[model samples]
Target: MREWLKQLREEKGLTQESVAAGSFINRAYYSQIENGVRNPSYEVAAKIAETFDINPARFFAGKISEPFTLALKNAPIVVAHCDLELKYTWFHHPHGVFTPEEVIGKTDEELGIYKGIPELIGMKKLIIEKGMPMKKFIVFQQHAGEKTYVVFGEPLMDESGEIVGAATVSMDVTEE
Candidate 1:
């Protein structure tokens, strides 16, 4: 429990004081909780979870090391991981919308769907700067038709422990 709190707090780049300020807990009290000297009530737990944008259940999920479980079948979605140079490293096309070859070496500017979405660039900037995940709903139209995608972007870190880029997964949620 202590390790989880420490790891998450560090990953978020927040000091105890900062987290306390955002959570309305005293710095010393938060320190005690993180150090295992104290256990927070349900109200405090909920507040902490909200302040961190974390699912409180995750802390007690127990023995489940995996942070997420997602299906990548023929689900009409496109997911991609990009390097700092804006080159794609990995991609998953659940709907067969576009071939991997088409997006592998291209930046967002070179991609048809994202070419003019300045908001996406802003989202990337926010994710990279804050080292957190962001989600938004986007509309796009292709040869087939128009669709709505629930896009999520999270910072990706490299070996030396520095954020290099991001991993994004967009799922089509429009009703057919």
Candidate 2:
């Protein structure tokens, strides 16, 4: 669901009908968008953003950029987003170690892939708490043997500039 959108509406004390009217959209459509049943087009997203006085780009936060997509396809890189609690919210390019289903809603500690290794999780926590970007190199002993990765993490911010989560990109460097 677009939980953030719903939270924003609730924060503003706006009903679905009011938000729909303000965005020039049907209430049912707005409801569908908020419930994650339908996606808003750029124009509709812009209208809704205007109604909420937020950047229209907020609606596209989940979208991966073209370069990122290309890198995911051609490189041994993993990208993920985690909530403030360190639970995975979105993940891609698992590099044959895990799947989206295995990672989402779970923390690194829960996965056991980084068990006893605090640097990766610590970096994410630092990013969320301090709203800063950081990079680290970590090693993991997997069934395939020892693998190293260079991980970059940055804070994910809401429309009001509050840190809500952390986004990370990790590239395997074991062969380097």
lDDT of each: 0.69, 0.81
* Pairs that clash in candidate 1: none
**Model 2 CA deviation exceeding 4 Å by range:** 1-70, 113-116
Residue-by-residue lDDT tens digits, candidate 1, 97-118: 5555455545666675453256
RMSD of each: 13.9, 6.5
Candidate 2 lDDT over residue span 27-133, tens digit each: 99999999999999999999998897655655665584556666578788888888788877667773667876566656888888553258788899899988889
Model 2 deviation from the true structure expressed as Cα RMSD, one decimal place: 6.5
Candidate 2 has its poorest 10 consecutive residues by lDDT at 57-66
TM-score of model 1 (CA atoms): 0.53
Using lDDT as the measure, which candidate wins? 2
**Residue-level lDDT for 8 in candidate 1:** 67
